[model samples]
Target: MSKRKKSTTAFKKANKFIPGGVNSPARAFSAVEMDPIFIEKGEGAYLYDIDGNQYLEYVNSWGPMILGYNPPQVIEELEKQLQLGTSFGAPTEVETEIAELITEFYPAVDKVRMVNSGTEATMSAIRLARGYTGRDKIVKLEGCYHGHGDSLLVDAGSGLATLGIKGSPGVTENTARETIVAPYNDQKAVAEIFNKYGSEIAGIILEPVTGNMGVIAPQRGYLEFLREITYKNGSLLIFDEVMTGFRLSRGGAQELYAIEPDLSTFGKIIGGGMPVGAYAGKKEIMDYVAPLGPVYQAGTLSGNPMAMQAGLTTLKALKKEDVYLELEKKGQKLEAGIKKNIEELNFPAYFNRVGSMFTLFFTDKEVQNYQDVKECDLDLFAAYFKEMINQGIYLPPSQFEANFISLALTDSDLDKTITANYKALNKLKAEL
Candidate 1:
């Protein structure tokens, strides 16, 4: 590993023009108590910082690079599309092909409307729900981030938690009032809210397995309970799978849990590395979204050929069933290694993992919500992150975020990461 070098200069320069020096808030690195490392490029499971230090990547572009960065198949497809053209602001045959591919994996998505980002998909979905049901209020979990759309950003987590913002500045109290926040894993809270405002609630949205709050799994029966309550209350259900989709399975969290949401939003791998998002559901509900129905949403860059090709190629490469099995194995190995370390070191910490996503919290308490996450030792985590970075292991900058495993992470990569983690944990203990 090379010595730490100055690489945040560009970001510092960018801050003068861009808010917080980042187009996305999490990249600001305020949560980790360090300046953000400007990445020169990434290949597979490695990220090369602008300073020329290479580290085993665990962020995976905040959970999209499942096939790993710049897969050859996806690159080739993008090149092919670049030759043809980029955006037409009209329609292309590839759009329907991708739509068909999506519905095949997710039969619940009989019809889909592609958008440019998860925010757009979610925003459009919420609007469609209100239009179809003619209701106003929407319910969301306190720590599940659905993106930056004014409506769905009500009870967001991730960057919001990192930045310590109570909520966005522009959101009016009147708009905030339209969104009802409920605790995750609490069916009673959900049921009570639906009971109290059943008629007024247009929809309920959540991440099926929340990666935002350190990979919190849905409590057993939590998803079923929500589905039952939403149906009984005549409220639509929206699964914000921007993080969980494609990564969890080809069908996303819905397929894993076997729960069918009335509406679902997707991002990340769907666009490969480009900006893309999509929302799809039963034909009846989807038919309510645009030209066919009154709920209007449009984007000039929606269904851009380049983004489509990248997503399609990436999805096709992931079609090999072994990829997920490999991810599960790698995920389990990493979790087991951390568990062993915890036992040996007797650190006051516990781990939560589901599939290829995991988080190590510096606390003994079971982490089921954002409140539990608030109790972790941030000082220990900060020291641990520095140590890990020094050891050429790249982890998420915040304790509240989960680590991602990609197909490119071989057994050796897992071994290196585990060893580095052990050293980091010991170093943190010494520091304390």
Candidate 2:
């Protein structure tokens, strides 16, 4: 590890032109009470910063690099596409091929439309839901974070949670009014909402296994109840798998949990680290979008050739390899080590894990919902973040986000992380 002199200097220069010296608020590292480090490049399981420091990174580009940085297969395809050219702004064969792969992997999706980011996928999906169902009101679980779209941002987790914003100011009262917010895993709240507004609600959207509120899993019978309730209410069920897609399993959280949603939005691994996103569902609902139906949506950079090539190559590799099995072993190993650390240190915080996604909350109380997650010790987490980073381990700066494990990580990397975590926690204990 080295001093962050270069990153500090860069931030000072950038502040003159950029708001807060960063494009995204999370990148500002405000949640950790620190300035962001400028990364030079990523290779294997590590990130190289501008200050000549290397970190065994756990953020994994916010859950996109499931195979880690610069996988050879994805790189090769990107290079091939580079020679062919970049964006054509028209239909491409590679686009259809990649869309076919998504439909094949997801049992609920018969058609899909590619977009530039997860926000676009989610925003369009909601519009399609309202258009097809002919209803205006939509229901979303608090802290699920479908995206920054006007209707879905209320009580959104992750970025908004990190910055301590309740909701964006510019959203109009009428738009916010249409979005009915409910706490995740609270079946009674959802049931009661349905009782009052079942017929008027356009759709119910949630994360099958939430990553935004630090990897909270749904309670027993919670998912089953949601599926049944939406079915009875004549409302579409949408799964925002922007974080879980192609990371949890072959078919994402839906396959792992055996609950298929009416519409599923994807990002992360499907883009193979490129800028891409997709929204898919049954043919009837998907056809409700664009040329085939009345609803309209288009993007100039949609299905860029390079993105399709990278995503297709990555998906093919995932299908051929024992990726999920390896991830499970890796996840279990890290979980056991961290649990041991907590026990030895006599820190009774709750840990949540769903496959390779996990979070170590700085609270003794269990975190099953947004309210519980908010009860965590923010000061302690901020201190822990400093300790871990100083030890050359890169973790998400905020407690609201999940730490990911990629296939490129070896057992040595896991051991180093465990050791660093123990040392960090030990230091915190001493400070206490």
Candidate No. with top TM-score: 2
Error of 2 at 164 (Å): 0.8
Compose the digit string of candidate 1's lDDT tens values, residues 1-432. Answer: 665456667777888998988888878777778888888899998999888899898998988789888888888888888988888888998888888888888867899899999889888999999999999999999888888888767767888887777689899888989999998998889888888999999999999999877899998899999999899888998998888888888888899999999999998888888889999999999999779999999999999999989888888888886888888999999999989988898788889988888999999889998788888888788888888988998989988787899999989999998898888888776766
Residue ranges of candidate 2 with Cα displaced over 4 Å? none
Global CA lDDT of candidate 1, please? 0.87
Against the true structure, what is each candidate's TM-score? 0.98, 0.99
* Residue range 1-432, candidate 2, lDDT tens digits: 679999999999989899999987778899889889999999999999999899999999999998999999899989999998999998999999989999898999999999999999999999999999999999999998987899988999999999999899988899999999999999999999999999999899999999988999988888889989999999999999999999999899999899999999999888899999999999999999989999899999999999889889988888967789999999999999999999999884678999999999999988999999999998999999999999999999999999999999999999999999899999998887
- Report, for all candidates in order, the number of backbone clashes: 0, 0
Q: Pairing residues by index, what is the TM-score of model 2?
A: 0.99
| Error at 370, model 2, angstroms | 0.6
Cα displacement (Å) at residue 350, model 1: 1.5
Q: After superposition, how far is residue 390 of candidate 1 from its true place, in Å?
A: 0.9
Candidate 2 has which clashing residue pairs, if any?
none
**Candidate 2 displacement at residue 413 in angstroms:** 0.4
